[model samples]
Target: MEVRAQLASVFHLDKCLGCHTCSVVCKNLWTDRKGSEHMWWNNVETRPGTGYPPLWEDQQRHHGGWVLAGGELRLRLGSRPHVLDQLFQPPTLPTLDDQYEPWTYRYGDLLGADPTKDLPTARPVSAITGRPIDPSAGPNWDDDLGGSAVHAAADPNLAALDPDERQALLAFDRLVFFHLPRTCNHCLNPACAAACPSGAIYKRGEDGIVVLAKERCRGWRMCVPACPYKKTFHSWLEGKSEKCIGCYPRLESGDAPACFHACTGRIRYQGVLLYDADAAARAARAPDERLVDAFRDALLDPADPDVAAEAARAGLGEAVLAAARRSPVDRFVRDWELALPLHPEFRTLPMVFYVPPLSPVRAVRSDGARPVSDDLLADPAALRIPIRYLASLFAAGNERVVVDALQALAAVRAHRRARTAGDVTAADAARLLLEAGLDEATADAIHRLTVFPTLRERVVHPPLAREGEADRDPGIQGLVGLRRRVTS
Candidate 1:
């Protein structure tokens, strides 16, 4: 019954076009400073390929996120000695090969070179050191090459697939990939916050935005790998750990985040979610197969009368509750069950959810014929991407949730086709909805919300109930007006 407002987000992966527009705007706005040359707070990673920082999902190497031991939930960092060793030892952290060394062409060499037989060209020089260096890797080096034998072969998701399925995914024409834009999940039970000895990282009480107080940071470097998503970074130049602020300043002004605003695909949705604080632990401890449903049960329906009364007792703002009632995040995640949390086995209870993309289920093509929108995918097993591969990312190795999401997506397409054209039978569309566990009305709403949502429908920022302090304080930056400074 303890209600708290969390500003959660959802990314409809089906709509993402691998454009990287969101990443570019986020970099220009926040991570452009001296200490942040290598930090990409918002990054778009291609699936079936090792993501940024290479093999980040391989927690065996990074030791990020949480694990259940002896029926108790604890951080994967293990004992105190392990934490100290991992934190202090530079070699244990991400090497230059892991996160590519940031480099820029030495334009001075290109422009002001002495006359030569060949046209003068800029040599690649390390951005950190002005010295010339050979460059090989980059953040998105594997973009669109998810089917490459070299890059995709190294994906941790492929480990979930069998040898035969893996070979098919790597084959020339069977290749398919999708974009996965990532940011700090701002998790309910953040391991980064728990792992920080300095207590510099904390989730804000009002909005649930996880923040690292730079003033209290001691350059411990523990929070970097402690973040399962690898969202936290150590600023070598500044001697502090930093991460995405979740664009709180823009949110306070009643505007969506820069990345959300700049997104061309309109794939991002942000809103408040009210959850029982006590249920988070229970949900985290649930069995792997039931973990997703358990987490979904944690969110209290904002429309419930008892929830409103309990929210008032728990100090949830009236405005915050109203936002939750109409939150698109709630509709996608809780109501319709379209969006599911990423890597829930990590047990961080990440608030950000993703609507599994439909690109993996390529329509069946016959001899000398073209694939059409009305035609449904023949079989999940014969899909372009393996279900086990997606299961590893979204369902923690359970294919049922992934299958359900795909079926729902297919039903929507068939439903729309039947309505607009005679290519698909209406009875088949209705039957598809039944198999997908969605009603016609629900499917239509999902269609509008995804394809034709207005700006207001897409973003639902709650009133933080800061009690008017933020507007009054002229010196405020990044919700500094509302929260207290915890100085060590």
Candidate 2:
């Protein structure tokens, strides 16, 4: 049991309001610079639509993540020798069009144009070239199911569904969609770190936050394709690669990441997770269908004595262990089993998990009139968003696990509604909870954490002990801390 402490997160998709506050705040803080315009370190994409880089989930084209071969995991891009050979020009690298040409409108045209001219207006122009251009795409081009026929129809996850199911889902009357906020998973087995030829990307030993050192980066841009999530990007002007740092500078000072702080929906939860390193390795190598279970098995109980002893041996401080014990992420993912990893088949061992959204109940039309199903609130099996679709996204095509999670979430809702609304009877709620393999106390606990987590409860991390390290160098210390504050 090679226990190690890692920072992890859970996003409750049901609560996400799709307000884009998290994305805007993250942009202003991190990627708002020349050559970084195309980089959205945090982006919210709509489901049933191609993501930012347009078809990024189509690993067949991007050649990202990892692949299992002969019971061993290897980079989908290729082996080290193959990667080195293509160092100069990566054949699978996504073009600027694929990522959308960053654009801006010429506001000066509107200001300076003749007053008599026919309704002076700003003209769209490329942010990169400063030339007139017709804007067609953007980071969230398919937001709210925009151009659904074209963009939403091309969703890669829909490949798992039968043709009949696909057609029914895309039908005019049954269209369904949800917001998917994304960031670097800060994976336990980081493909970006593994594919970096210059060794610029590395996970921090203390907290497991992946950092791409600008000084060490050679600008090979291998990390771009290697990152299955497409979170890594190249800085054309600076000749460096940049990615979400998980706001480490703030974290070391005991604050949450900017996105988490700015989130409008309060859907984000961050905390410490204790996992067995060896178990994580084995889990990553498990067959596709078993990946979710294997991944969950890899996470150790923070309160377990044996796990604590191993974590101590691995140099985890008491503070970190305590945080792990109180982690809301652990409760959602491990204790209640309501949250699951996104695309576990990618084999990145992502630390970020999601509580999949519960869609509207499927209804039927009778004699030109529609009636909601009687089991609208009871049967999650009547999910409007096909279980297979969500399974592809989170459970590596394992419908059973996805069904289990959705059922548990339904039980929580049922239990709460019974208590508050008086519409559902106590016996009915108990029966539903029992069917979902949950007791009343456990259901209430899950409900409380999901619906009413405090700021400290949502984001939990121990002191990083960076002050002593930062004190070693006054120049760096002055930048990272308040050492140079003018306090006469």
lDDT of each: 0.81, 0.85
Q: What lDDT score is found at residue 308 in candidate 1? A: 87
Clashes of 1: 0
For model 1, the local distance difference test gives 0.81
Candidate 2's error at 288, in angstroms? 0.4
lDDT of 2: 0.85
Q: Pick the TM-score winner.
A: 2
lDDT of 1 at 479: 22
Cα lDDT tens digits, model 1, 112-188, are 88888998888899888878999878878889883367777898889887887788777766778888999999998
Q: Model 2: per-residue lDDT, tens digit, 23-50?
A: 9999999989889999999999998899
What TM-scores do the predictions have? Answer: 0.92, 0.94
